[model samples]
Target: MFVQTSPGQSGSAHVVVLGNEKGGSGKSTVAMHVAVALLQAGQRVATIDLDCRQQSFTRYINNRSAWARRTGLHLELPVHRCTEPGETMQILDNESSELGQFLNAVSAVERAFDFIVIDTPGSDTYLMRLAHAMADTLVTPINDSFLDFDVLGTVDPMTYSVTGESHYAKMLRDARRKRRQLDGASTDWIVVRNRISALESRNKQLVAEGLNELSLRLGFRSIDGFAEREVYREFYPRGLTALDDLDEALGTGPGAEHVTAQEEVTSLLRQLKLPIDERGRRRAANRAEWFNQVNKPLDVHDILGAPQTGFQAGDRPGPRS
Candidate 1:
């Protein structure tokens, strides 16, 4: 829900859509952590889980609620599940009435969130297009593997020539054209290189070179998303925030959750050019370590208690033409 701003709090209405046409791309994980980080930064954040089919963010929120209940950890994050008109359909014409209806639904909810983070489905869909149309900034996460980078373009085996035309590129070009046509939206598309290796590997360098070339030719800026680690896996059973693992226990504990969180947060800060002193880093690490050492996996129901009473997903009136 939206928060009425007071004199002291900062309000920057930024809508971020986490999207990629590839599956298993860590879109949900990045969305949840970014939402958590934004909350910690003292902004009123509202999450829109648009992936109704998988409900990944919804599940994470449920687990977060459970963990909060069992451990007395208070997370003031509000996540809303939004369903567009034609999400089930495989194809949608930009000029169709259904497309306009979906766009209006997103615009209506814009008033409720200080920062709206939209989590989109893995592949191309009507919902994904709607989100792109509404996005102020688009964050795309990519892994350090050649197979994963194939979505961007295919590299020739012998000569290493990169093909320009690909499914992902065409979709992006179409989205850009749509933004130009609408004339009110400008999308800042950020590419996050995910699953990065700590040590320098031959393959890593090749992928880096390929991405660099692609960025120069295509005009998309690059940033390090998250380094390759096991912490991502640990958050599965019970979702944990980036700072949630800042304590020492999380990083060194059985799950390696804390370490993973630390790497991800540090990488993001560096990418954004934000400063994080040593003391602040150490404190978070200790807390994570302690939590992992003393605690057990808590049920989501235990953390969050119960479903939010009287919350329903109903259609709002269409936007004015």
Candidate 2:
């Protein structure tokens, strides 16, 4: 556990919300590991479980707590379960006052955490929309399948050989509109194609091309994201492979799994550009001191109030000439 910082100066309150209407898309799993990865890089991270129905992220955190007790890893991160208003057992509306309360609490926390990762429910509810509204970076994880592609964008080349629209494009437009009216914050939308295969397939190529084309046209960026692998699923059981022993960091072949778990985490950090550096000969703490500094978003106050000077005949106050 790390020390918390005072409010208004949260050392790491950057919020990254993971959202996708489709379930079983590794939303919770990705959220859990991403938070842990940040923690491994020595960041004081916190989580918000917007999926009030299942509270999957909360469950994962509980499992982690149990593991900590048994292994003495002492891993702990604050997981806030949102309480829906009206005392009814229904999905909370993100647009409701209750959702605002959650965001308010996030902002009002006196102690500063390094990162805030939100795990949204697996549906297109008002809460999901609210998560999108609050996200600085919205990560959409989808499996590498045609069904998932449809969620990201349109595929009817024949219907509109001219004007092609996609689900992802519409989502981006909606998010942009909300930002203008409410948050006034820019979003970095990343479409993650999860559960990809190692082998090269024509179908895979088509999906990749579609994603690339859509990203180029719609102003979204796509990374390798996560590939299909057992390690991710295994996390549900052991609460993710520990950072002390990672042999499959390189590969899972005969000698490919020689890398340590720490190395695997470092690899992930490098991939996400989260600022984790390799250790030197000495096993000095490889924790990053400027983790938050690297990914800091422009302060709206600074941007809006920045002074821009245009020289004019009497632009500056001076004695009458």
Candidate 3:
């Protein structure tokens, strides 16, 4: 039995872990977007990159900070931390060291932030399992092809039906079970079909069917993720997300593709159903109210504070001499 020594159950932050055993599944991209989206929504969000070697998540955040500095745009950034890989020769010693680092990082921000977005490496590791066990919401982004789906389950060649659970799926089951025993909390696992093609095809239908079947058995929700979009690739260099103000970031009007991409991202966030603070909900409500009143005539009391002195509603102040 893998005992959790650290105070993993005491934190208040909802930990969101992005886990996919296979590479090129868009885990880092999804993690980045989730963190930024939460931050934009008036939530205190922090990010942890457990992939010490690849560090794609870390680099993406660094790129965002650098772009913000160069362009002088106020880009929302998370309190980010990257765990250092162990250097010792002994496997157990290295595991202990790495575990300590991971726990320390979580403990530091778990109470302070509203959400902690963790990007795990492609391959399974001790740290990866640890992160999964601690996740409040686990997001697994798999490419649309069966090659990517193999990580979750094997499909029958004759009928293209899901046959059995895969290694990654089995690992998740164990982690979730352990988590339940430790804290009596269930991890909300979501499988996302990422980089999906725009056109419908026979293969696409088969994959969806397979996902639906597997999700029923595993108790996971499957959702359509970001479509294959060139705009996503363009956003990488500048550390931008579909949720960001594209017009200001790109210095031009956003196109139809950008709009669609933004819609996809927004839809995904809604499907995740992550918890939002009361303040966040109020802020969103206020924002919608403001937009609803954008075209309405402003009242003098609302605009000029009850007509202060000579100021009236819609009054334009004279330029200073």
Top candidate, metric lDDT: 3
Candidate 3 regions with alpha-carbon error over 4 angstroms: 1-11, 281-321
* Model 2, backbone clash pairs (residues 3+ apart or across chains), number: 12
Q: lDDT by residue for model 1 over 163-193, one digit each (tens)? A: 5656886788688779768865557677788
Q: Please give each candidate's TM-score.
A: 0.72, 0.69, 0.84
* Minimal lDDT window, size 10, model 2: 298-307
Over 1-321, each residue of candidate 3 has an lDDT whose tens digit, in order, gives 011122234348889999999988999889998988877665667789999889989999999878877877657777778888888889898888888888888877777667899999999899999999999999999999999999999988999988999999999999999999998999999999998988989989999999999999898999999888999888888899888887777798889999999899988988888886655434434543663666443222222111123113244322111
- TM-score of candidate 3 on Cα atoms, chains taken together: 0.84
> Which portions of model 1 show Cα errors greater than 4 Å?
1-12, 84-105, 245-260, 269-321
Between which residue pairs do clashes occur in model 3? none
Better by lDDT, candidate 3 or 2: 3
Give the Å shift of residue 208 in candidate 3: 0.3
Query: Scored by CA lDDT, what does every candidate get?
Result: 0.62, 0.58, 0.81
Better of 2 and 3 by TM-score: 3
Model 1 clash number: 24
| Residue 281 in model 1: lDDT | 34
